[model samples]
Target: MTNILFVCTGNTCRSPMAQAIMQHRSEWNVQSAGIFAGEGADASQGTKEVLHAKGIPFLHQSQPVTDSLLEWADLVLTMTQNHRDLLKQQYQAATNKIYALKEYIDPDYEQAWTELKEAYAQLEDQKLVGKEMQADVIRKINKLEKKVQNVDISDPFGGNIMTYQKTYEELDNYLAQLVKKMENENR
Candidate 1:
């Protein structure tokens, strides 16, 4: 069984919701934690409500991301590119297995994402030399931005139930794609 770990800024919202959704849909071992979570905090009410509406039961206690948890997961899927980068920086050994959830499931986004990163780095380097960003670089960045627009899942931490529901729907859709990809790989 593949062990998947979902991560976000706080365990109260996105990560736990993803854990619930994935667990309900697959037999794979699933768990979640946050990069800056306070231990034992309950999942947010909006998260709880949305999961209940979707008929996916979940109980969660917030916990900080730990090395042991990272070690346990076969895949470490973060809710945002920033979250994925943070883990990669701090836990270099796990970098190979870490990915932002959308980027992991959607291979079409991968090339654009790599090129975007390179473009951004080039832009930064030009700035260091006190040169203005070239028009071509700017255009490439803008195009890549559109292609990777959905790379990060929306954070619904303080939103109302409707906002939470929207986030849930977004996560559910990507997760369905994730399941299909994994199943096909196994086959």
Candidate 2:
């Protein structure tokens, strides 16, 4: 079974929800982490409520992204472009494997991925924090911005139930496509 890791900033909201939705839809061994997750933190109430409403009895504890987990995931799916770049910077080996969720589901992801890989290659990790390393990656991310608006899942933390519901619907739609993609990949 494929091991898929979903990622977000805090792991309280978006990534946990993505993990639940994807795990429910696919046969893959699914997990989630945060770029800066607090160990053993509870999943957000919004995430819990959304999944409960969907009848997915899910519980998640926040785990910080680590070398072991990076090695564990066959595919590392991030909730935002920032997370994607951060991961690739920290774990260069996974650069080829990581993708923003929207990019993975894009009809032209193959081309997008190739171009993104190229852009990522141009980045120098130490220079990324400053604007110096950004010219190329910025251009690529900007092109993606035109093709996919709100490619990052909106953070629903501190929002009301309706907000979380909307985020859930959006993620669920992409996740369905992701499940199909995984099935096709396996075939």
Tens-place lDDT per residue, model 2, 105-171, is 8887566656666666666444566575476578876786466554687889899999999999989
Identify the candidate with maximal TM-score.
1
Alpha-carbon shift of residue 46 in model 1 (angstroms): 0.3
Which candidate should be chosen as best, given lDDT against the real structure? Answer: 1
lDDT of 2 at 168: 98
Whole-model alpha-carbon lDDT for candidate 2: 0.87
Backbone clash pairs for candidate 2 read none
Can you give the lDDT of residue 13 in candidate 1? 92
- Give per-residue CA lDDT, model 1, range 1-187, as digits (tens): 8999999998999999999999999999999999999999999999999999989988899999999999999999999999999999999999999999998988889899899999999887875343254777888999999888768999998999999999999999999999999999989
TM-score of each: 0.87, 0.81
